[model samples]
Target: MNKKGMAASLLTAVMLVSAGCGGSDTAGTGDKGGADSGSASGPKKVVFWHAMGGANTKVVDQLVADYNASQDKIKVEAVFQGSYDDLLSKLKASMGTKEGPSVVQMYEIGSRFMIDSKMVTPMQNFIDADKYDLTQLEPNITGYYTFNDKLFSMPFNTSNPVLYYNKDLFKAAGLDPEKPPATYEEFQKAAEAISKTGKATGGNFAIYGWFMEQFFANQGAEYINNGNGRKELATQSLVNSEAGVQTLTWWKNMVDSKAMNNLGRKTDDSKKAFSAGQVGMILDSTAALKGLVDSSKGKFEVGTGFLPKPANAKDGGVVVGGASLWIMNDRADDEQKATWDFIKFLTSPKEQAYWHINTGYFPITKKAYDEQSVKDNMKNFPQFQTAVDQLHQTKLNTATQGAVMGVFPEARQIVEGAIEEVLNNKKSPKDALDAAAKDISSKIEKYNKTVK
Candidate 1:
């Protein structure tokens, strides 16, 4: 058969399997609880599994409750399933069973794995069927979730990394509070000055692997081969490339020069240090802006800046760092549709505005900015405008779109281990990155083989 014919046949088979997963259900049957309808007296139900914890959990619960109350045709039950890693693992364990979630919220790095599993109904399918307008959403956010010219998931809460600094510390160190560092050298200088002045340690960055990936993108460097895995399955890891070496070397030098503190792997620890005025600057997600602002309220002033890059680099930007919502294929058509409805409601401009102010995550829809609440939020918390400006100024490219691999979660852990190895003097920058690249490449090969 020709390529087009083969593609059509594969799609038919996939659809058939998906249909079969729902079991037999008579159309227009209200007595049975399958795709056709719910109980004889109520609406269809959708089980949504998510990973929002702590104070965020209450916000999620409220959203779910509001969604449930808004309509009687569909009732969504949102369940908090621990961290992102835990949620993905639990989904894996429940696959091919009758107890799986109808919809799941997965992190950005899990995209390849979710697609490879073939257990999700692509959001593009619903968009096409419903004639949904994708233009209203943030182009960069949708770009991150689009693969093979298809949007696999609906972007719910999207964010990118930013530089968080203490304005008081900057002023005390004889530096301009308004001028946050934009490049590596400037950041290094500021850090050293702050540390030397006894105001605070220059900075404290959590040894999070996401930072390395962001750094790579900021340099217009790909993390994996095959167009950052968007063109095709990535067969190699580029964690040892020039950009990677430069990133690690710079980080290690900061630690060695006492300009930055290596605050282990927990971002919370670094956040705490900064909040306590023990650290002048730290790197964190835009989602943390609200919390930092609230925590630093009267004690000190907080400032945000774009993620720093090398001085000479001019063509790169940070990748999206949050999660998206996916529809599970095993769910009944009614359940899936109800889930999609809930998703649409959640991403609506008004809801997005509510989510943006209540949480630090920026709205995924451009229309959300027009909401009076969001405008007031920007006015009240101008530091958030820095992240918004940085996001809009970014240039879309293969590097900035981010790498996709079935083994991305594992790859992140491997990169984080390499960072530790370099910082602790156990290995040179080149050697550590070379080792990480080799390890991730092997894992990628294994993951590709399993998926095939």
Candidate 2:
């Protein structure tokens, strides 16, 4: 059969499976409890699927409860959908049916795929229809969701990578604990100094592609071709370029010098190493600050700093890393309207400040910083200010805006494998990166064809 025929068949199968599944009929039932009817007997129920768990789940639950209590017209039910990958898979399986949630929290890498799925109503649609003011939100945070002069989703649980260091270890190494490394060279020097003391490993960054992505952004380099996939659909990966090579080479040298521990790709393992005082420094997300601080309470003093950049790069910036909320298009008009109201409530200044305080994620709204609760929280945990300052310092260019591609999850896996190979001395940085790029190019080609 033709490609179009195959695509149609697949979509039909998906819709059939979705319709066969049974669940609570709370979502997409706009007529029973809609705000338009002005019925006080029951409120419209909106289902929200999210990937948050553990401590973060508590905060999300509180936000849902608060939103439900604040209004009589709408009630939201928060559902935990495992990890981001799991959530995406389930969402895909449930598309074109009433079983799907009215709204979903999708991770950054899935943004491209979500757009291509054509199952979501772009936030811009509601914004334009209502003439809603979005000037209060942070431009840098919103830039990640904006593509081709359109905003696709609402920025939520936004985060960026930051340097976390053991202040006590730095002091013991005869380095100034207050002054963290600001450049790549300075970081290397400090790493060497800490390594010489033999009390702790110099650094312990996770073998994850996110850090490499941040490094490329710091150098104003694109991760994928065609302007980080913003100008057009990217045909290939550019992660094997000069900037990428330099960044990988530096990481390799640090490992060789026993200055940085190769902690594999597990973020938890690397975080444990740092919190246990086995490593003097580490690179991790700002979302981890609260957990790290809490874990290292009696062990040592934890300090936060901006991710170091290469000396020659004048435009140093980091990509916003996290998830956003997307409203499903299959819902009723009232359900869609109710979903938008919940999204707005969640992103309001008061809620943003509360979220930032409970979780270490950055507040997407600019006015959230001016809130007294936010100001007091920042004062209590001054380390969070480092993340805030770094975000503000970031410029909204194609590089910093981050790559948008349909096969980003697969690409990240390939890159992570290359990093592991380089760290293990199985392949040189250039060789591994070249192989990974080639593999990613093939994947991207296959994905583009399937979508077309």
Candidate 3:
């Protein structure tokens, strides 16, 4: 849902979905870069290229305006490249070239790939080099953006998946809106009841269900393993695990039982069924809140809540999702200084609050959460609180830390396709998952061997 995971790099919907949350990405308060950080004797100017659109990107423009007005020491120029691929291609082409921006916005799944490239400087170095105060920030939020023992990027547009429900459907189905679904049994019952209404083809619980690995992930299962070769890598696919099978099975059964509809699904689906009120409930990226709200056009009431629990649920916490800001190097001294200053400014509590209010993404800084401005805005609109509440509910792990692999997007494709076969009655859930595990293992092994 959030444009930060494997989907962010591979799926177009998730990336543009972020654009709906806030203003378009644009130039910052500092000057555009022609030189590097500085000459070790003068101010620096830097250019930052990102893939933000609409209002979400515009926030960057205003911030840049303010930064430029505030100081003469550094100047930053922010540019909105096309999509994730566009930015990546631009970055790839800029490598070793003089015409390159000093900062870039990267989606999460793209992180490890970039880290492997070794063309950019880690933000930990940036923070240490400047002595920025990262301690005041929420460690968990930043953890989602970190890799290895060092940080290559600072957090921005962070969010987790959430269950968005249609209250009217719940009421029509004779279910309590306040009690959507908290347990596995209850969720099934709700779907069954909604299906009984014959609103459409059975009852459809909308989302990128096949692609969203939240259930097993939330339960703390391994999507990848410690492998340096094919055997270990193949053994670690984890799709055959009890939790993994259970997760995939539940969805297949839901579709077979006519409690959920499997319709028009592909590699990338907009889930127009849910937003158009053709379905009852959906678990989507919190970053899509604004778009969902805008798309609804006030026809039906939107209810937001945490994902439901499992049958013998031993855990109830969720995981983090979304993207981060990466620093691109090769700038002169003045540009580096400007990029550094602007980077620090972007994470400030004030700006964080603005980003949260203007966009539904979570603020990375603790101060942003407690700031009166943020609290007041959330007070006026409580649904925003639901996302924040889920923050404490999630305890991070590999499943939730997200599948950091070279071919995760492909692995996801394998799994998602396997599930679709089951739902489409082309195969049984058990058989589908087994086959998916095999296909995924093959790719995982290929990727694992390539990794250092």
Candidate 4:
């Protein structure tokens, strides 16, 4: 049976289970009429669960400390909850218990699941109640979190994909390091030249589906059907479209020609290859800028450019990738209000500026860029400006806003598997992608039915 048919067959069974789960309409609102109605007697304690570690953990800790120090009404206890996948697993397991945090940080791909779970207060609820002005936020950043005309969560730590290259390698290959490729054709030419030098692989293969998504966006192509799952519940995958096939074919040819290193599906391996000067170029999230710069320090100069597109394409843009803060509906009204307050404090211009400077994540609030600290930081690390520019230049559309579906994470894995098959020569690009798309369609269909 086709994916839609399978979904239809399972809908009744899925609805039976879904009907038993509780739903929450008040996402960020506590029991109070508004955020201001939080307990007046003492500071309300709010627990925050997140997946940041290493340097990111330190930054988050400092932000929490600063927030705590700045206010006595809401004391936020930030807890590290392993990786994004780990956090999602724990969150699912804790839904039936009182152990879930009041505010949770969820990765972008989990947005659909979070909304369907009905376990949190939507930020729109709080915004409407408090008359909060969302104009201060960058539209492109907020666009990803906005679903069905409602902003579900507060965007935080947002990043975009960019091409990172070694300036030294570019110059050695007799190419202008400053003039990074603006199109895939140029990129291929540059990659070929860099490979001929034998000093490094021309490009590093990205194991994740993120690069593929970016390429699709660059081509103004949707990753899934139903307007990238924005117009309606998506029933199919579009990863086997001509644009996708072209992208995978290009990648396959690059790998076969030895212009790009096939580092498998491990992002760390690709990152290591690039940082060790074994590769000249790589496509990675802007969030890796700080670490990439630090690691490449004293070794070579690091440069960044917008993700390349087809030279003939008329329009291109990138989707925002990162986590956002959501307030759980299980908390007291005051606690929910407290969580919202903490979220506001974190997204404030000063705090966002601090975050943008310390961590490589892009500032969501527009005013954050106006801060002197952010300005000076950009001056020091000019590479960050490329990301900022790329975001501003992005044309907002369903394809660029990113796909929204409960099974997005699974869909990503399916795409990765398809990429692996093509890279390993087990299947042609079209065949591999067609199979993956079918699998994703089945998963999406099942998820949509299960949730409804």
Candidate 5:
């Protein structure tokens, strides 16, 4: 069963569910231009559910308001649906019913599940229908959402992991403040140097599964077989591979050396430790660049660097990390089209610029880089350039494109547990990863069978 090859037929299944089981297309407007003229009561409504929180939520609300103000045919009502996991669970519960949102935002790992569920329209259809120019968008970002040569969702908030270091601490440790570590060996030495300063610990990486995946990609290692699941459904997890074991071994060594602290699994906790000057460096998403800079404004100068790789690694790149917009197919044609229009407005160069500056996410549209605001932002926060450079430098390979599995979220949890076990000295890196890989492979096998 080739998953990507099933898209066209599954697209029809999605539409049938929308028109037959869900609702009829009452609005006559077929094109993307405008919706039907509503009665004197009000405009047609398009419901949108998302998982953006904190400062990002405000930005989302403002964007939604801007879109509504820009048009009168359709009124887009935005609803915050908690975290990404929560939003996905809610969408699952709302499937086949009118209660689901016309548009929803889902995390990157949910791509396989979304495609398999057949509950949403392929963004490719809208692109083909409207002659949308996808070339205008960032290819690295779009590559993640593209499956079976078709884009299933609109790449919205995109990001990658980077190393954040405290320059003040670096200088205090008699290290060059301008040069951040680029390899695991260099990272260990720098961590030891920073710790020797007695002012802050060397570094701390949250026991995060995403970081594990990134490290595997950093070494040009596939996280799963079958071209990281892009070529076909993945039946196994390669978390026990040499790259995976090397990553865990390096991480466990750092913790054992007391150069880096094991701060549990919460990225926020690790971020706070860095902000409070308790840790000199940390690994975090590019989307946190803005908040981290603000938190360390008066305390220390923050510097960014590419995610560390093994010293021997010759080829690898960071995978795109973030969420994308999905259009629920179980909605009226007018509402779905309206959702498309809103997505277009959001992804436009201008909006992407605003989003990039405000949220610290990569502007999915390339033209956004030409925006004056973006140029000024680049100048003000030069550390952001590291992420942009890393993204651009990435090669379009399966490892960099990232792995796709319906059980990705669960797999991440399993990997995190393995990390915890190794860091706690309860299990060897190979032993722990072997167990985690076995568990994830079992889940993958189950998922593939169920989907088939």
Candidate 6:
């Protein structure tokens, strides 16, 4: 055979060998690279992993299609992981290898976890390099992914817990649908009245409000030393603080008085109760907007409203609640570039505005709020606007950054168990929270050592 023919045969053998190895899976990441070392024509394929489900999932997939159609430079693929835990585990295991997708949607609390693994690219680097207007972003939401003044990730969806009421119940119970509870006292009274009436049961909500942290935030209390979660120093425990104790005590009282139920968090059963008119008021997540709206089955008009705070918490409002997005660093250079592009596209004003209107998540871009479509919807849909308005009311000091302890999930579970003890009369509020404080402090120390 000629020399050229021999080279062709040798190349085919190399291709077969590469395919059986794990190299072929790397391209499966959907990142693009061309024949030349300097290929920049755009990625031919990109893989995106997320845990979004149901009708909302469709919107995300459509958005991917829209991005793909906008240019021939990129082709995107979407894969749905069952839950956040599943996605986190999968991503971690695939790190340093090519089995992972180029882009993944991660939650706000997971931001640090992702960063600690050193598998994530600080998204702010990409933003700066591209000269994107970082200031064009809302300052409040940006804090979620910030660490030591550097932004490590892009926030995707932010969900805060709000008050959702049964409009007909509100009216029938002699309460004005327009005038919802503005303070914890008002909330208690109103919940009590609604419970006694046929509108709702007195104990609709339980020991813990939806989200669990609102009582502290609404009361203008600093949950910890730094809400931003910079805990390199020996962080003090705020749950033992005056505001923390006050909130937990009040919650205990609320449950004991039967104004709110001592039941568990929002579950499928809880949603059913609230939807079926068994519960008059619920402090639930904004993401549940789609769920509640759909489950109502047109039986009643679902009225959404801002969360009520304590009278003492008057003047300023609370910061946002819920999740955000982060990008993983364990991928090829081409994949990181592709993921960054997708992140920008997803957070663009048009997408933000649409997502805000459709889902319960808040938009991180001020421009999204400026859109005529968003404005029109706000006038038509007060729920979306209420959250935006509250976002500006957020406090910006270290106290406002929110929590970042590794055992946070474990800490939250401790809080849950303690709250349950209080409701069941198994322990006093002081004892319950005190026990949680001790447990959390210990866990925080252990996690700190690991990081240290």
Worst 10 residues of 5 by lDDT: 15-24
Candidate 1, residue 402: Cα displacement in angstroms equals 1.0
Model with the higher lDDT, candidate 1 or 6: 1
Query: Mind giving the per-residue lDDT tens digits that candidate 2 earns over 289-377?
Result: 88898898998999999999889975859999888999887788888999999999988999999999988789998888999998998
Q: For residue 85, give model 2's deviation from the true position in Å.
A: 0.9
* Candidate 2 error regions (>4 Å): 1-41
* Model 4 C-alpha lDDT per residue in residues 1-452, reported as the tens digit of each score: 54333333432222121100001111121121112223568778888887776677788999999999997777878777666765665666566456678888888887777777667788999999999999989999999999889999998778888899999999999999999998888999899999999999899867788788888987888988889888988899999998899888988899999988798876678789999999999988888888888899999999999999888775869998888899888778878987888998998999999988887888999998889999898888899889989999999999899988777777787888899999999999999999998998888877876766
Q: For residues 344-392, what per-residue lDDT tens digits would candidate 6 score against the true structure?
A: 8888999898877776677888899789988887776556555666667
Give the 10-residue window scoring lowest on summed lDDT in candidate 6: 15-24
The global Cα lDDT (0 to 1) of model 1 is 0.83
What pairs collide in candidate 5?
none
> How much lDDT does each candidate structure score?
0.83, 0.83, 0.65, 0.81, 0.83, 0.64
For residue 360, model 2's alpha carbon misses the true position, in angstroms, by 0.9
Model 3 residue runs over 4 Å out of place are 1-43, 199-211, 227-235, 265-271, 294-298, 332-334, 448-452
lDDT of 1 by residue, 275-352 (tens): 999999999989888888889998999999999999998599989978889998777787788888999999899999
Model 4 lDDT, residue 52, Cα: 72
Q: Please give the lDDT score for candidate 5.
A: 0.83
**How well does candidate 1 score on lDDT at residue 323?**
84
Model 3 score (lDDT)? 0.65
RMSD of each: 7.3, 5.6, 6.2, 6.8, 7.1, 10.0
Which 10-residue window in model 1 sums to the lowest lDDT? 15-24
Model 3: how far is 451 from its true place, Å? 4.1
Provide the lDDT at 278 for model 2.
93
